[model samples]
Target: MTDILGYRAKFGVLGPSTNTTVQPEMDEMRPAGVTNHYSRIIVDNANALSDETFLKGTALIDQGTVDAVRGVMTCAPDYLVMGMSAITFYGGAKGAEQWQSNIEEVAGVKSFIGSVSVVEAFKAIGGIKKVAFLSPYYPVANTEVRNFLSDYGFETVADHPFRAPTWTAIAEITHKQVREVVEQMNDDNVDAILQVGTNLCMARLAGRLEQELNKPVVAINTATYWHALRANGITDKVSGFGRLLEEL
Candidate 1:
């Protein structure tokens, strides 16, 4: 029999079908004996981003999540990770909790979701209370992120929204653009700089920014994966992603 690699843990990652960055970022951070398997929540239309359009897209994602969860469960993963962020951050902290509950109910497995993962990441990093964040979401979604963080007791010191034209455009955002947003958001009062939107591809950039800014620069993908590994009791301490994976 062929040797199966992920004898330690198999992570089932769920993302929107239109997202192009989460799977690649997760694969880049995969440690020895830890494998990542993906299942996409189908998004039939890639419409221009707006409050109305974004909410509609999230509804589609919600509709598709159960089926995607079912499909990934067939892999018999040791844990689950939600690679998308919007839905989890939609209502607030309570909304995130309910979303997780729904996932556990349907998938019959515990999972690491973006909203809760980021909160846990903050706690792991010494209970940082002030933060700056960047996102490719519309104004409404960004508000939800702020609300969710506020509910967790962290104050958003500053926020930058890319307002990417479409779901696909979120993946097209360049590292230079992301760096500029991070630079614009940073200040002495900001304890950390958070990059939301898994499709924004900020993992490596977050590491570099952390060195430059001398503070935590957390990428959602990195935080989500880190939460999964630690929650599963696999503390392999990955490098190059960010301090979340390396130190915490």
Candidate 2:
């Protein structure tokens, strides 16, 4: 018996409880008949003034991920899309692969990770190598993102770190701030620019930025959702989220 609403596919989206942006943003990218089931990883107080506290918060999210996966799996989703990126970026290229492998092993379905998904987006868009990215993460997490991208042969030309005070605060960052960072990261040398941190919500902004910047501006939420759709053989081109969803 096929699911009535989710007859195309049911995607299990894993994000942190504090993230307020994933649901609405991913939902906007959702194609007809494709439903997104979000399973939030519990993180009560994701406040951080130092690297330790930031990592501590992420540790809580990390620990809670397996349960989140199991919870989403109960819905019998055909695929899983990671709406959180920090843990997935940990341990570099091989680490990301192992991380995704573990999630897929437990989920009993193919999972799309932000880190891997962004890389795939690069490949799909083509002509992307030297990339700059902005993230609402501590310097430590930024390092992991840099390492992960480097392992995939994408040289990190530059990066801008927001270091949002708390997990919830990441969503509070203004579009102007993000646009300025993208402008700062953009130059003749950079091939593309990307925004990490799913809660930061750059899906809509990215599409507009691509037109303004005249360069690829990938948003994690958009890439992960696109990966989930394409990996599952759902090829409906979603516009207004950037070229990866529309053109690619």
Candidate 3:
């Protein structure tokens, strides 16, 4: 057996306070020798995708993320992993790059987001240009994600929104429902399926989803963790997730 901390790669994860999936799922999927720490943005409300919710969440996020970065930087982790998918794709390609830069500035180290990681994961498997997306956000958030992917040159061959507003509800959503959403899209043009919203539970079922879909289905949490580990030169492979971690 090998020592997990021998690799000594620390991951800084930024997620909503209500997010229960990213931390545990990422930890479980993470290979040996890597340690993960979390920072949370307060999201007390989840009604409409109104400016108020966005403002409050963003403000809380600013404060929370700074603390997270500072703490993680002290540990001198090789890379920072922004675990929130929504923030990554909030302003499209430019927004993603800007956010990554901000993380780098704050942490004084390189960073990657769930959105960017999944894109890289797809490309690693020779998947580029086309993909299907499944989101657990409302219409406004859904549109934002679609535009973001488009800006990155990924064709949104199909997309569907779960129309969920609250994080509690989103977290309650089962893997079966998630799989159903993917099946509903049924787009043959897409080379892979991407599911966003790290709050949702998908890591536990990532390998199963790929097996059932007969194509690559990259979960936000799984891909982000995978990329973060690889970015830090820790190539330990994990199991029970999907082909990406199993083979990448």
lDDT of 3: 0.76
lDDT of 2 by residue, 78-191 (tens): 999899988889999999889889888999998899999999999999999899999999899999999999998999989988999999999999999998898888999999
> Candidate 3 on 121-182: residue-level lDDT in tens?
87787756788888776656667788887877788888887755566677888877987888
Clash pairs (backbone) in predicted model 3: 4-32, 4-33, 5-33, 207-241
Which order, best to worst by TM-score? 2, 1, 3
Task: Assess every candidate by TM-score.
Answer: 0.96, 0.98, 0.88
Considering TM-score, which of the candidate structures 1 and 2 is the better prediction for this target? 2
> In model 2, which regions exceed 4 Å deviation?
none
Query: How does residue 61 of candidate 3 score in lDDT?
Result: 53
Tens digit per residue, CA lDDT, model 1, 1-248: 32289888888999999999999999999999898999998886567557888878778888899999999999888778999998999889888999899999988889999989999999999859999999998888889999999998999989988988888889999999988777777888989999898899889988988998889989999999998988888898888987888888
Q: Which stretches of candidate 1 lie over 4 Å from their true place?
A: 1-3
Best by lDDT: 2
C-alpha lDDT of candidate 2 relative to the true structure: 0.91
User: Candidate 1: deviation at residue 176, Å?
Assistant: 0.9
Q: In each prediction, how many residue pairs overlap at the backbone (N, C-alpha, C within less than 3 A)?
A: 0, 0, 4
